[model samples]
Target chain A: MASSKDVIHSKLWQEESEPGDPFTATACYCSGYDVYGELLHKASYVDYLYLLFRRERPLPHVARALEILTIALGNPGPRDPSVHAAMSAGVGGSPAAAALMAALAAGAGSSGGAREVLLAMEVWTRCGCDLNAWQTAIASPPVATRQLVWPDIDHFPGFSPYARDVSIPVRQTLEALADCLPDGCARWLLDHRQAIENLVGLSLAMPGVAAAALIDMGITPEAGEMLTLLLRLPGAAAHALEQGEMGFRRFPFFSLDISNDPGPAMPKEGTAR
Target chain B: MNERPPLETFEGSLNTTMGGCFPGERAVFRGHDLHAELSDSDWIDLYVFGITGRRHTPSQLKVLHAIWVNTSYPDPRLWNNRVAALAGSARSTGILGISAALATSEAAIYGRQIDIAIADFLVRARRAIESGRPLSEVVGEELRTRRSIGGYGRPVAKSAADERNAVVLAIAKKEDLVGGGYLKLAFEIEEFLLSGRWRMRMNYAAIAAALALDIGFSPREYYLYLLPAFLAGMPPCFIEASTRPEQATFPLRCSSLIYEGPARRAW
Candidate 1:
């Protein structure tokens, strides 16, 4: 079974700097999908490509976009699900992604229509994928090992559970985007940063601390400090902290003294040199 | 595409609903249902018949207006997309309902006039947005002009909330008494129309709009306004209203006294 980390890396880790056009980006994302082989990390990549293409055209092109998607997915890979830990989550082609691609392809005939396609592609892709989902997963801790399976061509599965389970890397990616995209098309990404992060963290299979680090980076340092505090709590509080279920707690992080060392002093009002 | 009904179907239906037409191809009248005549005064009546209480939100009313403007005239798809964009923005931003039906319904109304009217009603219920006057005031005033021709009375509520809820509740009750498959079908037709795609080798909206004009609004209005009410009654499941049941409550809301059925039996 492919792990979440492998899935994400396969779809998004290509070394290419920027996709020249919608077709190339889509092609890049589906670089690992092959009909006869095990499903590759094509989930996000294919989804990303559709997102790009969708910005440029109407949804009618989805069938065609998907055709291109399948073609690209069908071409690459050694096809071993075991090589990728990322393959653990969602194994299916995203319906929303397919819808987007079909809409794009249906608009202008699939040739020389890059400019319009590119313009439209920018609208949906500007925010990147929803990230809060990843973060939520990462802030959560691990449990028993289980068999991981990728979704088949027709169905995409394993989204919700994975999002709540994984935490770290997902948060990192979200932080990276929030840090980078705030001024442009990415502003929307921040709105659902929590959800996106939760999805990403789970999809990527990162540690809980990694998620905390990401939240710290994307939001405030104080939030990071609080998460760090939660990690040290005893019994269910600590467990809940690791699970990203800090909602039901009875006390504040400030009240708990996890570490034996004294914490950083609070800044006084109007301090001078 | 070459063999579509003329715009006259809509106009003719409007004429019949307002006055003479004994259940002809384009008219259906219930009682002295003068609601059709209100169109002459540039007013449209909203028949809400169900729940004793619920009301239409300002935003819902605003969205309705946008839907009506885009659907009521030619190029309903164009308006549908624009309204969908607006509605999508509001929904994604966490400002309104998060379900697909309302969004789909709002989007579907673009090319079809009755759908447009419902959307217009939604838009009208909103407090004045961007524009200075509230949409409800605008629609209500316009509706008043139709009162002499159509015979629609004002709701009993003095407050906006009371009036809006009365409308919503009325529509809900009517929908519960009758099945709401027609509204669902209308929603589907609108989606196909706004999609601007030709499917089954046909541009669905043109077909839908023509049919809408032929069957007209009185039937559609009752069906649409009552949709929310029906949905509330039933639990969630995929709705296959158009295909499963061959017989439908044609103009379920409107009476045969005003308009007729399809101009061509094909529909």
Candidate 2:
């Protein structure tokens, strides 16, 4: 066990210069393979992604689960804020990087995005793997009444506002994917599905399912958000490119009344400047 | 068995040390009671203190606030504001539209990052001048090596006679913040640059960055501090554009585009 002082001294302050060059290498090794030389041509994109994050190739079921989740959350339609932002930037003739950056920034808030997913993971960790405790905590009052509040627990990060039964598909997907995994958070989440539903009064959000699967695969919560963001980048880029081709088009809702008539200017209110 | 290290090994938290909950009863901020401090201190002071872990005098606070207020251009034609306007034109959500504009605000040439680079250069140049190097020599050396000074040129205007610059400088003068080393170095460099054939003039970025350095912020801190300088201007543009018809902002047709490629061919 480390003491407080020991931990303080050991706190990580990484120096990049001391290490041998990690960049500019001839070939990249990921998930126990020469990715540049071989895996790039042979492996599936999802498999490569799994390898990059986990540092080990995923099981068939795990890879399938990831594939499905990526597909499901890939677009979220142009109506989604991040995609809309990208499209908007593209419409304004911004570069691809600007569009993508705008999308990424838009996705960083407390809404159904990466930050919220990370918050959900934090809550899961704080609950000590106890589903009942997690549910009770989520159902608790706000910070003023409860004396303490977890970062985004009041909003319940992993629950969707659009639909209550969203968790059903997520639960089914996780169950199908759990065959190859060690019995841990992923299994726990699957096992306590009904109970979670009863307590939250809604199905688990896709982010919650993603958080569990990622945690079970030895991926950290922060890494989970990053991976999600990476998967969504292509979709953002595609939307942006489409918008660019559309020649500065606007969405339907942009048509609104622009009136200039103010109810008879109040006869020169004070002394005229 | 291995011997343990000493217990007095803890150093300090690096950046912020302002406020944290004390578990049960109350919160503490910068070694003062949060409630007590809130009642007595201005909110801007509290905000500055929160980021910097240091308090500012009333004059300093006024000048800092003025920096932000002066740069709030309501015109939607500006680059960042154009982004917000376009997002609104596309009927994007409020969060999406605003964040898109903020992200565009981080561009290399005319964004927050350039302010930091310019400030860093000014600080280094000031130190060099202090060590007996001529200001002209330093400016000449910098221009020769880097080709372009980060904060000197304005893309939109030919001259440096901007109302915004005048207003910000006036505030700085009023608050007695015009005599700092960085500010002096910035003016000297500007004078040298203006004498050259290019006739480059100091833009608002240079002035803002110099003032930021004069106020005792490090180059990195100045960059972060100036990140929200144009934030207030973005929302109005967004709101106004959103209220207009879709794609009303600079809409173009396919026929209007210059097609320089080979005559139309089938796939």
Instruction: Output the number of the lDDT-best candidate.
Output: 2
Model 1 chain B lDDT-worst window of ten: B249-258
> A-chain TM-score in candidate 2?
0.71
* DockQ of all predictions against the true structure, Cα-based: 0.01, 0.02
Model 1: per-residue Cα lDDT over B105-223, one tens digit each: 43222222333343233233222333576433444464465321011111222112222323332443443411233333333433433353321111222222222222223424533
Reference-based TM-score of each model:
0.19, 0.49
lDDT (C-alpha) at residue B214 in model 1: 26
Q: Residue-wise lDDT of candidate 2 within B10-116, one digit each (tens)?
A: 22332334445534445557655676455588866776776677788889889889988988887788888888898889888666677778767876677776776
TM-score of 1: 0.19
Report the error of model 2 at residue A203, Å: 41
Instruction: Tell me the lDDT of candidate 1.
Output: 0.28
Best by TM-score: 2
Which portions of model 2 show Cα errors greater than 4 Å? A1-273, B1-18, B21-33, B39-41, B260-267
Tens-digit lDDT track for model 1 on A188-240?
44455445434433232212222222232232233322322222222222222
Candidate 2, CAPRI quality class derived from DockQ: incorrect
TM-score of model 1 (first chain only): 0.20
